[model samples]
Target: MMLSVIIKRTFVPGGFPIKYIDEIFKAIDLLNVDSKYVPREGQENLMLDIGEAMQGEAVLMAEAGVGIGKSFAYLIPGLIRSKRLKKPLIVSSSSIQLTEQLVGDIEAVSQILSTNFTYVVGKGRTNYLCYARYKSGNKHKDLTDILTLQEEWKTGFIKPMEKKKWCVDNCLFNQCEYRNSCDFYNMRQNLKPRYTSSVDCIIVNHNLLVEDLKKKVKLHQPGLIQEGHSIVLDEAHKFEDIVRDAFNIKINIKMVKRMERAIKDLEFDLGLNLKTMRLLTEFLEDFNRELIKIYAIEGKYILGNRLDIKELMSMKFKDMNLLLAKFNTMKSELRYLDFKDSKEKVYDELDEMIGTIIDYFESIGPEVSVYWAIYEKIFDVNGLALCSAPKEINKIIYELLFENQKSIILTSATLGGNVPINSAINQNRAYYEYQTQALGLPESTIYSTPQKSPYNYEENTLVYLPSMDIDVREDSMSNDIANEIIQLANIMDGRTLILFTSKKQMESVYGGMLLRKDTFTWKLLKQEDNGSVNRLREEFSSQKAVLLSTGAFWEGINIKGPELSCLIVVKLPYPVPDPVIKYKASTNPLVHEAEMMIKLKQGTGRLIRSEMDLGIIAILDHRIKAKKYILQSLPFRNVTEEISVVKGFVENKMAQYLSEQR
Candidate 1:
């Protein structure tokens, strides 16, 4: 491995530490030669490029198709680099499932190497239950629920910061009452100094990385730029949109009401002073009333192009200070409470919630960001957010992410965005090109490549683009899509996934299907409508079911063989014209179009997870015929104008799989 990497690392200018990568992957026994051990042609190549990418001051953008051993292609290089350089290497992914898989795979690979490396799964602190806080506060029923990594609140016993070494806080571990029993704090105390500070790698989801970057920006710390540290983004394509979401500071009504409810409940149950809770509640109510009034007028409309942070700061000066002061006073009052008192935890959380709200209020003053308010009736959510829409993420990336870095590698199966966040049309013409530039790194610091999947798509897949006679431009489109899906599922014998652009539309289609439930032999499962994607995935993989989903179902799902045979694209994934999309499209239409293209690609990519799996993609939208860019990455083996032909293709694939099993 070392010899191969050294020979191929001519792309980047640096003395390659070829030995480290060899040490990391040498024990990975691919020679086991089992059903899953088929070595991909692009895997070794990706590893070589990653090795060069990790050698020194360089940025590499590589796209490897599914089943390309992408995780280790970068992981082995990153681990070796982190170990050799004695700097932290961050491997960030878009989803928690991927992050957890990397964490586990890193350990397995290290064991194979006959070596040990310290690594922590970096997530938002709120995902872990603060043991001290949990024991001290009211035992809310919500605490009993199992928490997925996506949750933001730091409460309950669910997933209690399992690694004690990574749980270090500012407190002296020995003096803290909960130290011995505190899973998170204790872990951090021992491991942070013993490991994390010197640890080789940190596995984190994109959200946490973005949040940390946002904090770093606000604090003005020299960001991710230690001498030896480097970075790798597994699903790098999602970074821009993830960053956009992270940078936005939203104050939703649901959160405000939750705060009020927390205060009121604790005040009654813990015997806390009613005076303080009342005061807080009154202020919150006033805030909610103002938001509701605005929402009543402009349902989901953006307030303005930009908010003057100076004006917001001055506008709420006295009220803001009073609220902060009150929370501070409440926090101080906890000192007088008994150490064992549960009321202490309640007030502590209350104070933190208040502080978080204040932080949002303060986020707007920055010149690089845009602030706006939006009112929407959906989920009854409405609030003010510090939005950095349609702007200079590339500048931030170059200045903050790349400075003082050794290597940066970005990879994703679908890297579809084209318009630059802040680039002019004269500078770059395509979204992907703009995306490559928007990272703002100097040309000298970057090296790039693309990889095609080893899959025989021409032999294994069919793409159906049938002309629809039904009028789909009207409100009845949802019903039309539902009927087509019903017909397709019956023809294919009930293994289909229908991807929708809007949840409302998905629900409407699902409802339409329900109206004639007896017409089909398969079960229909909708994302969120029937539990989460995890649950839906299990149900679908285990049985013959037609899964109707949007958003989350497009990617990060695998249903091999006969369990999944068809994918239906309800639309071309045009993002709902939300404030963020509206603002972005206004500046550059390509920005919005690129996002839709990326989503369309992701939706299409859901089919054929395995090289042996066969599936058909039925694109229902006629508009896709005009949007040729959506088909740029896809190579369809068969493109037909008939639904029955696609259905026959699917049925044949399923029968073939069954015969192979026999």
Candidate 2:
């Protein structure tokens, strides 16, 4: 069958590739799992629609509710296509934590389908040990951390250091002389061999993928290896921020000091001779002197306002270019110095140290904007150079994804508001107003696209809000909201998820709530308990008690059965004031205004993870009442049962809502 041809036949209801489907059903059949695999009514058609998207070259913007299995909806088809077309499927997630979960799920599904596929995680170059650096550690100063970690691994004081500890500049690939028996390098090398085998699916985070697209554009080109290739972007809502960060450049004083310190360490501490040592020292001294001079002239002023680093640097354009040329020359020269068995070892260290500075200087030009920062005594060094990639993030997305005609599946629990995809574009400016002005990107020029969520909200789940007047925001003068919660606890009993917008509110309510002591025991759990989400969910289910937490508790939590019959959203989570938000809000009026809506939706989404999961959402914010703006954007405004509170019978109203629940 041609990859472009869509099949007319509707597949069976049972999933084809995923093994967890059986386990999912088994849990439901045995009543071990609280939620069932119920896609919202007719939205099952979305699965078919997505199947068509995977079969051809098209972009899908699916906006479904929290309960619908959006990940499975896409993965099952991707796996089947991989088998039929003999192509490699690569899936990228938004975060490391989410990446881990999807990897596990893919493994389970692959086993169940009886398919032979190899999975390899693609990370940046920095994640492996630099065999080149190990050959000549005598050239660099900070071998303390690396040497101690290696010693720990040898004595089993510490396990093998994960990829998180390594960087591309420091990584020594298979060429490392110690590849035969080195623990750290050997383990990583063995993790993913070259894709000579049928490695059908590759998984990555959106940030990593987008970063690769911007930083390593040639590496991500489709059909490079002739394996049937496709990209699945999970949690697609976060693509904008990832794109933004990937395109933008941040050069702060902190980086300069680290390089300066490394150079100083190589010279004074390591007591080693480097071919580029004199050149680097001379350059550093020159750069340091120039920075001190600039700082002295513009000490009291802010970074960009007083001295535009780009503008000042450009004034000496020819000299700077010559300096960079010489730095590169010195870099190439270091590679040829022969010091014997380990004489060439300093080449990697010297190359890395010099390259760090060269990268910073070369990155600054007409296409780059530079900023200067003044740090206190942390370093005797004056203001440091900060340079950023001049291109807008949307431009990078257009160049890499849209311009390439690659099919993209963008899915997120929170992508767009009532406004279409067009509105979401550059809406981040409202949150990043100041930075935009500081970096100088036009606020009006960016484009925002809107599409519905891919999850099925109606059949999969309904948004529930228990009507109440007790606002958690009220302190001494108003009645404590806990009084109302204590009453609701009595009716629904202990199986409730009490979600709070802040820890301050949760503690207050928990303190005021009435406990049954024996018949209905209540246990309070906060998000800061140093427990994993799964562990907390397990605790909530086993104890059949109320689990109270702030923001993280709202979304990314799945619970069903008698253990969690109620979800209490004590308050609407709104974005608090911060430097980033403040900066953006100063530049964009629309985004600045709608910050509350974005945060509220993200917070409310915590409950009703699936169709079988039922719960109550009680918003304690008075802003929703006075503004009327917040009310219109709330999910399921019509179906959510509302109760007006007038007198002070918080308990009676709570009793009525709890009694109505199944």
Candidate 3:
């Protein structure tokens, strides 16, 4: 089929004007005239696939490999659609960094295409400065500095101000004295469809997008982004987890303390000694005693069979009901009293908190939700929380996002991990099926052929698996991995990123390295030893260093050239068994292995970031040797099980890098 015919059929049948499709083609052709334009076949194919999905108003899942210019692929079609439809195109990503990067990419795309479009980046209420809180006698130095710098700032997103102390938690909305001047309020107002006729695109992180959907569902209000808009989910693999987190409800010790403080403040202001205050105090003491007994082992545990819901209702819900009745009585009393508006707002806030807790407990059941208790030490403070997340978030996602939108496009590089270059059928069909079931996409959802990365990974990258047979579950695995890292670090001249699945393992390996630090010429850095990850990355990037890190470093840290030449995988990135994973495993036994493949792909992708980049990856886990599927999922097939082969490969890459430096 001709490409133009495919474009026409895809868009015209679905109500898009043929002229707009023609314009898109012309704009794409214009790129050839520009000296900076490099024509990539993969990028063009993905762009057309997204365009078809948008015009057809269908759901699409696409996997575009690294360096495929995915942001441009989606943005080209998204911009055209928004312009023609005169409706905002909503683009969501997993991180604030990615969201900001998309904004920059959109600006560049607009310039390349010679099109003008207005867009706004939507963030959570907490990210922006709350004028109401600032004006309410907050004399904190950080707050003052942020306010002083407001003119220089574009979004008023001050990271230095403590969120809990200055965010819009207890906001007064229209009643606030600074509502007209509030940065958060003004930004939200500007995001509304009725007010934002000029805004062609709305960029937001996944959390804010889900929160907007929640607001529409629960509050019956127009969301931060317009409903039924064409949406693109960048880094779409993380969307399911983000939706689960946004919808999960929890009540922690801090919440209980806040309720206590609010009630006491109300009593002092209104001069009314209500019986609800005494009941709340009694409930707090009883709840603490019960938590102390239940949390004998400090971690998350399923609450139903282990700590029977019926028993929980008898102990906590009964008192909660009594407290609810007392609060209801207090609400009636406050209506009759001549209290200030702020005090009345406080009373309503407390009432809602108690009501939400009661509703959460009432809704807890095996079929509808997974209830769990969390007991963990955070920043040296032992905390307890009762939480519940909807077990079938697939249904929630379908109803809230997929069912109502004009079109939905989900795209990522590691969507199913290194789909084969040119298979007649998608070799990763089972993986895509798993994602569809997990995300609740329609049966007819379109799946784009995975666009392979154009980089020369075959010559530039090697996957090294050590022949050692140390079990990762055993205590000795950390030392074994540390020894392997020591050898690889010396071979690569200390340009290594050692990744771990467990923080404890990382610390143990760091300790092992510290003992032999005197022998190495380059600096050895641990993630926690540095004040922050950014600082650690800065030092690692600017000098010859070996970094020991876990978590966020596995992905999203991009360093081209010799600064990050070798990557080490200490273990496969398997998810720890938590309440959520436990429930998922009950339904799909391969959930753990599936998660590890995606993360393993991400970690391996950290090396060979660009075509000029040359590096080697070492997988220290012996378990990967047993799983042939995992090795197949990675980008490069230059595999070796011998340590000597790894040393030789690293030496060649180091030589190439030094030659280029001259």
Candidate with best lDDT: 3
Residue 634 displacement in candidate 3 (angstroms): 1.2
CA lDDT, every model vs. true structure:
0.63, 0.50, 0.73
Segments in model 1 whose C-alpha atoms lie over 4 Å from true places: 1-11, 17-36, 111-118, 130-183, 190-193, 211-225, 252-368, 372-391, 417-431, 437-442, 445-447, 469-473, 658-662
Report the lDDT tens digits of candidate 3 across residue range 521-581: 8789887621445547778988888998887788887888888988998888898776687
Per-residue error for 496 in candidate 3, Å, reads 1.0
Which tens-of-lDDT digit does each residue in 574-605 have in candidate 2? 54443334434454544443555555666666
- Per-residue error for 259 in candidate 3, Å, reads 2.0
Off by over 4 Å in 3: 1-12, 129-144, 147-168, 172-183, 224-228, 268-342, 375-382, 417-429, 529-531, 658-662
Clashing pairs in 3: none
Residue 267 miss distance in model 1 (angstroms): 16
| Clashes per model (N, Cα, C within 3 A) | 10, 41, 0
lDDT of 1 at 68: 78
TM-score per model over all chains: 0.75, 0.59, 0.86
Q: Ranking under lDDT, best-scoring first? A: 3, 1, 2
| lDDT tens digits, residue span 555-632, model 1 | 777677767888888777766665455555665556566666667767777787777878778888887677665565
